[model samples]
Target chain A: MSTMTMAKALNAGLRRALDANPKVLLFGEDIGKLGGVFRITEGLQKDFGEERVIDAPLAESGIIGTSFGMAMRGYRPVIEIQFDGFVYPGFDQIVSQVAKFHNRTNGRSSVPMVVRIPYGGGIGAIEHHSESPEAYFVHTAGLKVVTCSNPNDAYWMIQQAVASDDPVIFLEPKRRYHDKGEVVHESKPIALHQARIVRGGTDATLIAYGPMVKTCVEAATIAEEEGRSLEVIDLRSLSPIDMVTLTHSVRRTRRAVVVHEDVRTLGVGAEVAARLGEELFYLMESPVLRVTGHDLPYPNSRVESDFLPDVDRILDAVDRSLAY
Target chain B: MSQPLQPWGGPPGATPHADAMTASDEMVQLLTPEGRRVEHPDFAFTGDDAEIAGLLREMVLARRLDLEGTSLQRQGELGLWPPLLGQEAAQIGSGRAVRDADMVFPTYREHGVAMLRGVPVGDMLALFRGTSMGDWDIDEHRFGQYQIIIGAQTLHATGYAMALQRDGLIGNPEPDRNAAVLVYHGDGASSQGDVNESYVFAASFQAPVVFFCMNNQWAISEPSTRQSRIPLYQRAWGYGFPGVRVDGNDVLAVKAVTDWAMERARQGQGPAFIEAFTYRMGAHTTSDDPTKYRLSEETEAWRRKDPIERVKTYLLDAGAIDDGWLSDLDAEADALGEHIRSTCRQLDSESLAHRFDVLFREPTAESEDDRDAHLSYLARFEPLSEESAR
Candidate 1:
């Protein structure tokens, strides 16, 4: 195991995927020489050559659309959409074509493609730069949407996403890209759509994903000082959400609070709450609560902290749920 | 009035069709707008009168289907409909020209092509209804799903063509039986990066594909003037292939062109780019109001060159059908319209619930759990009985 930032872990994961699969090709804007704006694809183009690590034109839709054709031609294309907000330009290709190609061909053709997007807010970026658009892809069927909170999961999840048979929307938490964690270099490969229990407890369950996963873990640590035991489940997959893990945790804790960096309205938390209420109705001490970002565009850098949920907000929700 | 604007890259005295109709060209338009048949001498249409009538009937049906779809949109049964009102000649002609084995990649507005491929009209409406993604199997129909993203289909068609050729499927060396792909886009799509990249890949690999661009004058509110400064058809010559412009409203001309192109492709010749000069009689979609940007005079001028009306006029002039037969055809069209209206209504309630099933062929364990939870929650209103559960 090695301690590394989320960016380095992702770089290592991509290197492992490229070394494992000869067919894996990386294509995106500025991903070649610049190693991407975030440097997540650092040193890939130099090692893999231009053919495999293509620096595509600045068209997001073209990158994804052509990658679909490439995947059909027996190439496993791992595309980077650059940013969460920019993914909309390729929304038509991602939703209409990439997602439906399997069922449209009656399973004769499958898109073994991965679209990596850096999502969520808190970096205080410009307009359309810091947005959580996972709900759009998650709502659309035929897409497998997943996200990683820390370096270890980011490293393994990207490789798992690339290996999946169905098209996977791998959303990286841009805000958490530099956060450090111990990453196991080689581990038993996990399923792409399953949730992992980052920290186990007994008082209540704090479910989160992407950037909020770390926040939830921090909230759990703070809650320990306040004599509240909170379990944190990192929901790795957003689309095919791991309800089994969620329900089991809720059953054990008898209370749950879902958290995310996206707007509270119709966020992934809603689905989690609705599902928990139905499956584990008798196993609850209180109504399922959520500590999420306000339903507004990510505010300016000065007020961004007020818009995003932090350790205090998450712990407050836990206290409320425990009091009930 | 002004030297006919000399196409894109033609010679000083070159006729529009002269430079376009090369033997190696995939865009071999045979008929000129003056209703004159000009063959390539090397390639000819050998079909008899009966075959011509069948082709005309297909075009007529395609027009009827398009009209029916537009009407369905007006009735609020569809989320949107990109009307193929004036491009029937281009779609029908090219659709009929392709062999059964050849694959076709279509943009959103290829209703005529879908009809030719035998996709049920109800299935096509499902896309607009937002009830289903696409209803037909791409392999079985040999027609790709309607791609809403502009110019993306060109790459798919190119890749498929490459696969077919690489497999040595070009049977019988005497009259090469290689499969070809026809990818349809619009003049507006010509400005897209993917379309140009598709041209590069097709040229580089010598893929057996045809890039069919229907230059229908307008893309929503933007005119062809904004899309290109020159005729889009002639742009193909720079890409190492011939490009032709045909009066897309003329069904005969479009059929002649597409047929010749498909034959060249089957004979192992490379890709072709065709520019079908047509007009859009309606708005870009149901939400669009054409009156906001377009002039009434322009619409009226294009109406005179209506694809269906021109074919109807020529059929009557050639004594191909009498007034009674025309009336019977109108009645058939009316029946199709009625069927579409009723089918659309029936689909509203039935198609709304299948959104989950189409999400994944094999739903992940989590998705299965989600669906189960949703069903149980909905069951509270009317609990499921043993029979209902089964």
Candidate 2:
């Protein structure tokens, strides 16, 4: 086991996937020489050669559209979206072609490609870069949406995603890119779609994913100090959510609070809340609550901290759930 | 015959040169409208009598299938049919140009190309018949699903070409070893952003692909002029590739140009574009009405240049086929039409549960639970009671 940042772990993971399979290719804008804007694919172009590590044109639609083709050609293409908001240009190809290729052909063919996007906001950045677009993709069927919150998961999940035959929308927590953690390169802690319980407690269940996983863990620590025990569950996969794990935790705790960086209404938190309410309705002691970003466009960087759901907002929701 | 739509800012008829139908000076025509062979400075008509007869047979059979499809739609057997009525030469000539190893990415209307790729006529009609999305195996036939979204397949074709490049399939001296990609779209699709971006990616990567645009003169209610101010083929020059416009009704010329383009790609000459200057003599699909937009006079003019008629005329004038052979070919077409009619009705209507089966390689818990719930709900309806059934 070695200690590394999430970004380095992701780089290592990409290198490992390239080494393991010759058919695996990396396609994106500025990912080659520049090593991606976040440096997640740094040094891969030199190691894997330009043929595998392709620097595509600035057009996002072209990047995704062609990647779908390469996938059809039997190549496992891993595409990188430069930013969360820039993915809109390629949205049509993703929803129309990539999402439907398998069902459209009646299971005869599939585009076994991975589209990686560093999402969520914490550090001060301009508009479009800091938006959370997971809800849009999670609403789409035939796409497996996942996010890694730490170095350990960043290393293992990237490999697991590349190994899967279905298309994965791998969302990386941009705020956690530089966060260091012990990563065992030998094996993954959990499967790609399973949820991980970070901090186990019995009072109230805190459901979070992506960047908010780290925040939930922090909130759990603070709640412990205030004589409240919070069970923090990191939801690895957003689309095919591990409802079994969630139902088990919420069933025991009897209360739940869902959190995320995306907006309040119609967010992933809404789905989690609704599912928890459905599964644990008779068993639960209180109603499922949500502590999420406000239902507004990502505000200016100066006010982003105020707009985002921090530990205090999470604790307040936890307090409310406990009050009920 | 199409009256020139006034150029973007210019007066009407001022850009008559832009009219694809009348702009014949730049087109490569090996077979004239009168069934006479003409000498071209660039392309050569190298087919012998047997090869020419083979082209005629395929074109006749393809047209027969198309006519059957139209009749079926009218007879309420099909939901819709996109007729390739006047573009037979463009479809047949280009469809026969590439080897079986080369991949084809066709728009929804390329039924002729699909037939050449070995996709059964019934399987192609299944999409229209609402029996299934498409049941044919794309990889087995080296053809992609018939993309309904306009021009989206171009990007897939370009990317597949790039894959060929990475696999070292291009620039092979051995002719049989090298392979490329052939993508077909219409003039209306030329205005799509994805189509232009495909050119950028193909040129940038030097991907082996041939962009075959069948300029069918009309895009539903809009004329070809609505899609382009300049000729559609000339757009390739801006992206640093060679583009050629051929007389789409001339089978010999379309085949020759597509062969050259595919050869250039296989030889690592990057991408090439071929604009088959043709006409869509029928409505865009069964639901459309040509009388709502285009004039019959224009349709009459294109009728004189009928692709199949010209090929049949050429064969007769050259003594390549006799009346007996024509009757035999007609009988073959009749048999094929009958086969399609029978097979289309026999297509299995898949169960809704089949959707959960194919939605993912491995079903997630959510999908599984949903499927179970759906099945249980369906099971709640008791099997028809004996008395009720009677």
Every model's TM-score: 0.72, 0.96
CAPRI-style quality class for the chain A–B interface of candidate 2: medium
What lDDT score belongs to each candidate, Candidate 1 first? 0.80, 0.89
Judge candidate 1 against the unseen true structure and give its global Cα lDDT, from 0 to 1. 0.80
Model 1 residue B200 lDDT score: 70
lDDT of 2 by residue, A1-324 (tens): 999999999999999999999999999999999999999999999989999999999999999999999998889999999889899999999999998888878988888999999888877999999889999889998999999988999999999999989999999999999999999966546889999898899999999998998889999998899899999999999988999899888888999999999999999888988887777788988898998889999999999999999999999998889988
Candidate 1 structure quality by residue, lDDT tens digits, B269-317: 7788778888988878878899999999999988877776666655566
DockQ of each: 0.21, 0.80
DockQ of 1: 0.21
B125-187: candidate 2 lDDT, tens digit per residue? 999999899768998899888888899999999999999998899999898889999999999
How large is the i-RMS for each model, in angstroms? 3.7, 0.8
